[model samples]
Target: MKREPSLRERKKLATRAALSRAAWSLMVERGLDAATPEAIAAEVNVSPRTFRNYFASREEAILYSLAQTGPGLLDALRARPVEEPPWDSLTQVLPAFAAAFADQRHIIGSLLRVVDEDPSMRAQHLVTYERIDRQLAELIAERIGAEVRRDLTPRLLAAAAAAVLQTSIEMWARGDRDLALPDLVREGLVEVRAGLPAGAAVRVSSPSPAG
Candidate 1:
C-alpha cells in the first residue's frame, strides 16, 4: 500500500546513501576528521550544502549508514503468513538478515572499537538499536494483537532476539572472523523459543557430579 518514490526522490536517496557510505568508509580507514562533511560530499560529487540537507554532520551520515542493518526485519516479519508462529517466522526470516551483513561484516567488526572510543558514536549506536527494538515490539504486537503489548511476551521476545543479534555481531567483531553469524543467531533464538513453551520438551543436559 505504500507509494513508491519518484525518480527525483530516488536520486536524492541514492546520493544520500552514497554520501553516508563514503563517510563511513573514510572514517573507518582514516578516522573521523578525515571524513569531514566537505570531504564526504566531494566523495559523492555533491556540494557541502547538499550533504548538510541530508545529514547535520559527518557523524550522523556515518550512523545513518550503520543503522541500515535493521531495515529489512520489519518487512521480513510481515511477509510471513498470519497463522505462522511468531517464533517460526522470526527464525526463518533471520537468515536473510544475516545475508545483509555479508558485505560489511569486516568493516563493521573493525569499527566496533572505534565506535566504543567515541562517546557520540557510542550514544548514537545505542539509540539506533533501542529504536529498532521498539519497532520490532510493535511488529510482533501487530502480528498477534495490541493486547500483547500489555503483556510482557512480545516485548520480551523482541528484546531477547535483539540480544541474540547483538551477541552474534560482537562475537564476530571480536575475532571470530570466520564465524557464521546466522548460525549463532539461529541457535540463540532456538534456545529462547524453546524456553518459552510450557512443559517444553527440549531440555539441556549437565554432567553428573563426581561422588
Candidate 2:
C-alpha cells in the first residue's frame, strides 16, 4: 500500500545515504580534521558544493548518519497498538533503535569523541536533537490526539523519553566501562516512566544566571 520513491527521489536518497556513510566511515577511520567535507564528497564522486547541499557541515553529516535509525524508531513506535500506554509504546520500540546503534557503535564512539572535543560540533549535535524532539512530538500527538496541544502531557513525555534514551546512548558510546547499551537504554526508559529519582534536581544551562 506504500508508494515507492520515484527514480529521482530514490537517487537523491541514495546520494544522501552515500554521503552520510562516507562521512562517518572517513571520520571514524581518520578523525574529523582529516575527513574534510571535500574528502567526503570525493568519496562519493561529488563536488564539495554538492556535499554542502546535502549537509551543512561534517558534524551534520555525522549526526545524520546516526539518525538513519530515527525514522525507523518513530515508525515502529507509531505502529504500536493504540491501546498501549504511551510510554509503553516507546519503551517497546526503543530497544530496536538502541540495537541499531550497537551495530555501528565503533563509528558512533568516534563521533562522540569528536563531539566532546569540539564545541561547535557539540552544538550541532544538540541542534540535531531538537529535530528529533519535534518529530517525536508529532508521533506523540498522533497517539494522544487532542491532548497534544490542549495539554503539555505529550510534549513532556517526549522530552522525558528523549532525555533517558539519549543519555544512555551517550554514556554507552563513551566506552569508559563495559556495558550493554540496549539493556542500559531499556533500563533508562523504565526509570523515566516511573519518574525521576528521589532527590533529583534538573539544572538548565544558559548564557547568564538569573539575578
Candidate 3:
C-alpha cells in the first residue's frame, strides 16, 4: 500500500545522510567554528552550494542526525497496538527509542556538549525538539481520541514525554550513573505516569539589605 521512494529521492536521501555524518564528524573533531559549510561539503565530496541545497547552515547539517529522533520515535509509536492505552503505548516506545542510540551514546554526548557551548547551535537544538514535540502532540491526539487544537491533554502529555526523554538522555550522556540510557528512560517515564511525586527543592535564601 505504501509507495517506495524513487531513485532520485533515494539518492537525495543518501547524499543528505552522508552530509550529516560528515558534518557531525567535523564538528566533533574541530568544533562549530571550523566546521563551516565548505569544510562539511568537502568531507562529503560535494560543493558548498550542494550543502545549501540540503541544509540551510552548518548547524542544521551537523544536527541532522539528531533530528532523526523525531521520525524514529513517531514510527515506533505508530507500530504499537492501537487497542493499548495511550500512556502504556507511550511508555513502551521510549526504551526502544533510547536503545536505538545506545551505540552512539558518545556521539550524542559530544554533539549535545557542542550545542550547549554555542548560542546558535543551542537555538537549532531547541528548534529541532520543538518540531518533534509538535509531531508528538499530533500522534498523542490520535491515540487518545482528542482534537489537537481543542484539547490540552495531548499537548501536555507530549511535553511531559519529551521532557522525560531529554532529561534522561542528558543524565545518561553525563555518564554519572550506573544504569543504561534505556533504563533511565523507562524509570523516568514510569515516574511521570506515577504523577511525579514531589522531591526536595533547592531553595535560595533572601539577600540581606545593604546598610
Instruction: List, in order, the clash count of every candidate structure.
Output: 0, 0, 0
Q: Tens-digit lDDT track for model 3 on 1-211?
A: 6799999999999999999988888888887788898998999899999999999988888888878879889988999998888779888998888887788778778877887789989999998888999999999999889998999999998999899888888888878676898999999998888777644255678999999
Model 2 lDDT tens row, 12-54: 9999999988988887778788778999999999999999988
lDDT of 1 by residue, 52-166 (tens): 9999777778888656656678888898999997878889987568757766677877678877788877777787788888888888888887655496878987888888788
Once fitted onto the true fold, the runs of candidate 1 whose alpha carbons sit more than 4 angstroms away are 147-151, 176-178, 196-211
lDDT of each: 0.80, 0.81, 0.88
Candidates 1 and 2, the one with greater lDDT? 2
Clashing pairs in 2: none
Query: lDDT (0-100) at residue 207 of candidate 3?
Result: 97
Best candidate according to TM-score = 3
Best by lDDT: 3
Candidate 2, overall lDDT?
Answer: 0.81
Candidate with more favorable, higher lDDT: 1 or 3: 3
Candidate 1 matches the true fold with a TM-score of 0.83
Stretches of model 3 off by over 4 angstroms after superposition? 200-211
